[model samples]
Target: MLNLDVVWTSEFAANKWIMPLPADAIPTDKMIPATVNAATYRDTLVGAPYYTDGALFYFRSDLLKAAGIAARPKTWDEMKTACKAILALPAAAGMSCYAGQFDKNEALTVNFSEAVASAGGTVVDAEGKPTVNTPEAKKGLNLLVDGFKQGFFPSDAITYLEEQGRRAFQDGKLVFLRNWPFLHASLSATDGSSKVAGKFGITSIPGTDGPGVSTLGGRNLAISPFTANKATALEFIKFFTSEEQAKKRLALSSRAPAYASLYADPAVVAKRPFFPTLLTSLNNAQPRPKVVQYGATTKAIQEEAYAAITGKKDTDTALNDMQAKLTELSAK
Candidate 1:
């Protein structure tokens, strides 16, 4: 819709697109600055955030306690060390250390972005310059590559998407799972289907040095630029982003609200006790590369990253190949 010029972008999308947006349509002061920043482009807002998503570190609290682990892992190294300890126990024989989306798909793109950002690198700068071959990015990508090689991550994870990894965690086959906020509700359902319910805890995704950055995901409301009902459209956008609606959603669903205040709302807090952790994750989140040909760029990264994870390409070779592919995509 943005490329086709059909939709009327909100201040959030306008900001993301680096173009001018109507001032009056900007999100209200109640919105979170980090979330507002995520939707803004080039200092202009073009979308109204509805819900926000970010990667959170989920762990089997029961398993961690049983293994005598004292606290959550704060870095990738710590997580791996903890995993090593957990796997050594007689009861955790069949479980793996960690899991995330490693499949050659768009989900892989998100995972790759988080890995790179955690190491303090960006795939593309604001000017659209490719930076996939940088040392920081290499360090980030190496974490994933090395994990697969050393068996810190399951060999079968190359085919796992969100649901696949979620199921693995839900089935109690994984010690840690890197995923979005929705997993909390699914795992905590009152139904008897979930084995990890009330047995897990959520925290910030383990970072390279500390807490890892997350790839931002969520829905934003935008209007059609060509729409005849601009007035009605803007009204709906305003309504959707209203504090009331946001609070309602926070109370009803696991969807994280765009309003900062909702994170502290007593009603919301009562239902989602992990809102504080999720908020921190969102604050550290970064969006995927903002390019018109994002799909192609993601595909290239996926192909190269998956190969590296699967040991088809060494780290340097994979980084070099990814840089070349991304550079080509940016030029178009």
Candidate 2:
């Protein structure tokens, strides 16, 4: 058996490196729908959905409360309004509005995907073709480009990876952050390492109209196509993704569970208060572009998205460039 990132499902299946799993043998009905989709390739289950991840919108609850904002923002405009109020406070003098993984790497691809998805546009069509020249797509990419242009995102955010953005939020230097679930544990720590400990809250990422869709992230387990012990591999995969083992993994490492019931479990909820919100995000999540040539596809995204957000190219020109390049990649 092989452990694989969700994005690798299509690649492995297309290359015949992994065998398609028997649908009747895996309890996919009990797993998060998005995760199950991630393990599928061309409508066939090629892997067992394992632990999963989705991004959360983290903000300073204390600042919002102090600014007299009682409700969390559910749209981009609402978030911007709330940021305006929060930043006007004497305590928030130097804080920027938001940050995400914006560097020119795989992280950039994920961010761009989320931005496009949140705006009700898709980076690639259901048939795995590029579709990024639409109005919705332009609106999505402009959120990042305009953020930099309007000073909503800090100047240095172009250099930020996940850890850098996490540190900024934990240090109370940001009013909001777009990041993954693993940040909850570190930000909740009572130690002095976290300046915003006990002062922050998490929710679904905001969108142009309402809640946003996150890029699905996690690992899947697949049987090697050449494996001799197919039955044993199937049995082990069942055990590994069982509800019992999932709970243990949750308690031990704080890995998000693939099963939906665990998100509502009292014990689990008590330990991780963000599970309910995270479950919503997961349900609404969309996997990053599922393509056989994922590496090249992501590189194309990062290059154009980086150029636009950094002002090296206008949003229109950059997306036009991205669309042509992605078209070439999809053709191959």
The best candidate by lDDT is 2
Residue 174's C-alpha lDDT in candidate 2?
Answer: 99
Clashes of each: 21, 0
Candidate 1's C-alpha runs over 4 A off are 1-20
TM-score of 1: 0.92
Model 2 scores worst on lDDT over the 10 consecutive residues at 248-257
**RMSD of every prediction:** 3.2, 0.8
The digit string of per-residue lDDT tens for model 1 on 44-150 reads: 66667777788888998887898889989989999988988899998798999998999999888889889999999999897667898999999989989988888
Q: TM-scores, in order shown?
A: 0.92, 0.99
What are the lDDT figures for the candidates, one per model?
Answer: 0.80, 0.93
TM-score of 2: 0.99
lDDT of 2 by residue, 237-302 (tens): 999989899999886897898999999999999989999999999999999999989989999999
* Candidate 2 stretches greater than 4 Å from native: none
For model 1 the local lDDT of residue 75 reads 96
